[model samples]
Target chain A: MRHYEDIAVGERVELGSYTVTKAEIREFAEQYDPQPIHVDEAAARESVYGGLIASGWHTAAVCMRLLSEGFLNETASMGSPGLDELRWLAPVRPGDTLSASVEILDTRPSESREDRGYVKNRLVGRNQEGDDVISWEATNIIGRRP
Target chain B: MRHYEDIAVGERVELGSYTVTKAEIREFAEQYDPQPIHVDEAAARESVYGGLIASGWHTAAVCMRLLSEGFLNETASMGSPGLDELRWLAPVRPGDTLSASVEILDTRPSESREDRGYVKNRLVGRNQEGDDVISWEATNIIGRRP
Candidate 1:
């Protein structure tokens, strides 16, 4: 188990691989996005993206999956206040394998609270080709055990 | 039909409303996020957030829906180059009606090309209760009519 005490500033955590599937991307886009470039392959071929592409929101959602399966499973995580920045650096296509890394940037207890602390981390998601897909910083409130 | 040649700076586009639902939020959480606060209302009630809350990505997805159904539907848009910022200021719950507004900050055409241009815009989303739920800035490549 990863207690608040176990995490250090500048520490890096490598999240394992995640694959992007046409079915998954299509499902997500159909429900939330429904953009031609994201859901319809033939239309995507004629669109500006040049091919079917995963929605940027889908890319970020996959990154969140990595965060959960890799880091949150072992940590005493409360929840994040929110993200500060979210950038879709490049398009994600079906069949790409996504890997991620997180860096601890800052940690501090709430000024008014003793048992709860916050950790700021920079999360980066990359494709199998070593290209960045999404990058953002997340601020999470965690519980500190006495 | 709205052509890409017409979207000018300082223009404001009002996208329609999106209604949040517990089922949609839960399904999104199950597939990608699965955070306690996002997946289980009971667990969420015990958390610091004190109630069932949608995932931040879920909120962003709703904002995207508003953009697609209204703004994108009216414009000859290619695709975004990227997003500059995304701030999730508050939680969104079931039954929240999300409305969005886009401010075109700048527009620049490809100097060497005749068929494409870029637009920078600030997109803000508000919940039914009049709370700012999300704010983001993005750059998209728009198409020009022949």
Candidate 2:
């Protein structure tokens, strides 16, 4: 398992991928972002998007899943204070396979706590066509080895 | 329905609330976050949080739900290109009620497209004790009145 000290700045890692589906997008929209463009295919076709699209939040959640499966599970992740930015540059449609790349931008030991440190990462998600779908910068607090 | 022009700058609106539950937290973590502090209760108890806590992404999703239910449903929201920032200030625990307030920070007609406009909002979420738990600034593209 990787601890806080094991992370090196400027290192990049390839996270896994997820293929989005119409059902999952609709279900997620129904619960959290029930906009017409996100939920109703017919209405979406009539809207500006010309068809159904996933919520930006849904794409973010997919990125989170990739991050967890790729690295957070094997590390002493405490939690995150939050994210610096989130940009959905392209529409995510059904059948779009999304993969993520994470770059460790910075790391520092917590001044207020001895057993913990922070690692900042720039996470970028791209579609099968290599078009950028989502990007964000997040800082996670990880435990230091005793 | 609120059109793009209907959104006024500096207007603060109540965006409603959500009550976090342990079951829901674990369910979300299992699917999207899957960290020990978020999914495994026993391991979370031994972690830095001392108990289970909701994932920051989950809290952001809740905020999105509130934003949709409170305002986006009534507006001509095309979708958002991105968000400027996000911060998870405190741990959201089971039974903790989260309420959100949104302030329109800025609004302007889209320069590139005459059919749309841009609205910027600073959204803040607070727990039952009035402690801020999540906060973010988002920019939404809204359709202009035809």
Candidate 3:
């Protein structure tokens, strides 16, 4: 598992790929979002989205999945202070294939800690067409393994 | 129900405040986020967050609830293209009273369809201390009944 000591500026990681599905979107929406455009295809067709669309929250949750499978599970992450920015440029459709990439932008030791540091990472998601679907820079405090 | 024929620029909506509880945090974390720092107080005490903390996703979800109760339920909004930006500035903890405010920043109609327009909103969430916890800008495609 990677630790604070292992994170370095300029490090890059590819998080492979993910595909969006109508079932998943509908399920998530039914449980949490519950918007007409997210749940009912016919209602969505009559609505402004032009068609069924995924909830923005669902998109963010999908992003977290990528983070977990690609980085968090393999790291010494304590937790993040917060996100600096998150933008969803395009709709994540049921047929879209999304891939992710992350770059370590910076790292520093915590002022109050000798074994922990904060790392800033720029995470980006793109569709198969290479168009950026979402982007965020997150700051996480991590501990160095003794 | 709010329909598409109404809404003015500069509208400000006050979503009712909600009091966060530890049980709610734990339930949300267990089902949705489930990271150690968010789920286990003891583990969080040993981690960087220092205590059980709400997930960023949880904050966004709560924000959605406010929108539904305050604006979406009263507006003719169809859906959004997507979020322009999302920022989590602070941690929201149990016992915090979270309130949200949404301001209509801009409104414009489709050149070909005067009956339909889009609105951009700036939304901010604040805790009991009045500290901003999260902020976001989103685009919503609203309708104007002819």
All models: lDDT? 0.84, 0.92, 0.79
For candidate 2, write residues B68-124 as lDDT tens digits. 989899999999988867988989998899999999999999898999999999999
What class would a CAPRI assessor give candidate 3's docking? Answer: acceptable
Q: Poorest 10 consecutive residues of model 2 chain A by lDDT?
A: A76-85
Error of 3 at A90 (Å): 3.1
After best superposition, candidate 2 residue A69: deviation in angstroms? 0.9
- Full candidate order by lDDT, most accurate first: 2, 1, 3
Superposition error at A71 for model 3 (Å):
1.2
lDDT agreement of model 2 with the native: 0.92
Ranking by TM-score: 2, 1, 3
TM-scores for candidates 1 onward, in order:
0.90, 0.98, 0.77
DockQ of each: 0.56, 0.86, 0.32
Residues B19-54, model 3: lDDT tens digits: 778998887776556677778899888875678878
TM-score of chain B of each: 0.94, 0.98, 0.90
- Residue-wise lDDT of candidate 1 within B53-144, one digit each (tens)? 88888888888888877787567777775675677888888878889999999988889878988888999999888899888888877778
